[model samples]
Target: MPRSPWWGRKVARLPERGTLIVSTDLQGNYEDYYALKQIYADEEERGNEPVLLLCGDLVHGPGEYFADPARWPDYLGTFYRDRSVDLVLDYAEWIDHAKTVALLGNHEHAHIGGPIVSKFHGDEAAVLDIRLGDDAPRVHDLFRSFPLIAVAPCGAVFTHGAPRATEPDLASFERIRYDGYARTAINDMYEEGTLGALLWARYAEPEHAQALLEAVHEGEGRHAFVAFGHDVVRSGYEKIGKEQICVSTSFGCEDRNKTYLRLDLGARYTSVDDLREGEEIRKLYPKA
Candidate 1:
């Protein structure tokens, strides 16, 4: 099936005035999902509407903890798929408020044979059977529509992984233009180890970060910053270069290890702070 025309746009512009964007990697953790809801609610209560951008990994793939024999069957059934859908529904308010933009993560790509295919082989079929089943087109559509990379109006880039470029330069990045075919382009970058394959990347060196910022600025014509979440950094957000920031929202199932990035977006300046050891929504919704 052809993808929606919306995904064809390479970069999306945020509100010109300013918008707070909450970027996080929710690896199918109910606690993190609920915490995100509270974050959005809290921001709304403060009279400041914010954009909630999910940096992918919304569903824990079979390559994750599902490898255990006890969890494989359930994961293949509806556990992961249902949770993925629930995450979207929980943030549906942003769909209208600030317009939530969910990027495609490596785990999300695993369902459609991205880099993780080598590890899960046949298990991918189980995911397809449930997510793309006759009655679940909506779930499949949601994943299909997710963009590989999202560029904010302020020139900030939000992606699930770091860009995959061999050379840390703006020229190399400019060559990687997103003219539709995003899935294929991302997969090719993953295969070639280029900076454009943000979903499959793990780390960005200082040079890579500099190159990415320049590329975004030159290609999009604005001062740009790149923020991504993939590799978990227990210490909180890390600055690879002056223009790049990495955050690990998942603390590996430990309550003490949780942290996320609070971004203050402005027409002139963009700032980010590490929010660590904060309140968990589980305290309020015991059943959730």
Candidate 2:
């Protein structure tokens, strides 16, 4: 059977007008977390408000180490719990998970604490922070099940990582659902040893990135814009083609600098920018 179109697919329903702030490849740097919070605050100060879209890697080091929550609950829970509390509900209005959206990166997928070699295996993956004899799901579960395709009413598709060129499809957001796993395997297949492992770490190159965009644009909605994080580009946002956009906010782990995206549906799906180097996002969308 033919798959449903990406545009107007409605994988998940969301508000028409809201800001999307996304970051990826964060190996759990404390400083980046602080900066991300500030970005959230700035967006709230701005009239459009915002949804924090984190592509993955919330904690530091390899993901295999995180499979056991009892082992690193402090590392994972501290960050996750703080965010849920630190923000005063009265400040920026939001619905359910509307305030935050997250997806698992290679690190989170690796189980965060397993044997070093297992890090490259997908099926070996496990959720984080749930094994402490707890009754509820933990942070890892949230990222694992994140919708592969996030379609904004404005017609934008957001994914954690970009797809590879062999994909060769455009104009469909649904492709992201299956392609995401392939992208993860490719990350694990960089080479025979450690060097290849390191090379596969970042998300870049044009071919794969473009294929994913084309798939999403198939939706044929208002704007077929594709937003994503992963693969730190010194240049930041990249226009792979007329209908695709890639943005990275993890300006490296040590650098205090951070970048996030913002979108306004009412504006004909035309405006998109990176907020970094301490610039206030409120300038474009004033706080209501």
Candidate 3:
């Protein structure tokens, strides 16, 4: 775990020891949120000091307002009401904020001035704030403090989106200002400008990830993968090229197939294949 400022840290360096639990794109899904917590809690109860990394998009989920999502068939929008407001309040008061590391998703950036993320209700970030009422200010402060990406010693970099950057260096990340960027609706692409690309890229080719890895650890994990969430990976996880893996823990994915990373910090993974399914990649509720 690392300390954070009132604004942003831009990047996080994960602990060199202990179990690392990585989840992504929760997006106000109450079911998966609780499942994640339970997974962490179980690890703690087992005397494992598990570090949880939530890779952004924690808010602005489509409630009944957006109608039944076509891709996410298991979404129980009517019954449980997995509203972003509740997620905010629960997250704010959750006993584990100290152990939880969050990434600044583009949706979250909308409130604090990064990009306009509109999904269910136009300007969903603003709508979340208005709905938050008194808690909005406090929650917004917490969101502002979240990092854009986390670098781990296990030969992997965790981020909300593809590992896109202005310069091919880590020091450059500290200079980001988080200004809003334009979305090219013609191609349905959200291009992150000079400030930050931490929450934009929807896809990452092997070469693209190779360039990113070359900048970190002096190419130590050049053959490794960058773990991220942004697109809706059908199996809830997919290997992209040779150096990128997308894991969709929640939001617009199958319940049984949705996955998260339970990585061993002490063990260095050489490639995405080292991340074995049901071993390193665990489903929310796997059936026997």
Instruction: Give one digit per residue, the lDDT tens place, for model 3 in 1-288.
Output: 122221257768777778899998888887788888899889979978788889988887765644444543454322234567777678766634447778888788777766566677767777788889988888878787887778888898887888654346778766676553434341233354523455778765576677777776565857667899977886779887668889988877766678899998888987888888889988877861
* lDDT of residue 13 for candidate 1: 40
Quote model 1's TM-score. Answer: 0.67
Per-model lDDT = 0.53, 0.43, 0.74
TM-score of each: 0.67, 0.54, 0.87
TM-score ranking of the models: 3, 1, 2
lDDT of the structure predicted as candidate 3: 0.74
User: Which residue pairs does candidate 1 place in steric collision?
Assistant: 14-153, 163-195, 164-194, 164-195, 164-196, 165-194, 165-195
Worst ten in a row by lDDT for model 3? 71-80
Better of 1 and 3 by lDDT: 3
Cα RMSD, model 2: 9.4
Q: Taking the tens digit of each residue's C-alpha lDDT, what string does model 2 give over 12-104?
A: 334566666656655544445556666677777876567665655454333544445555443232222222112222112232423665544
RMSD of 3: 3.4
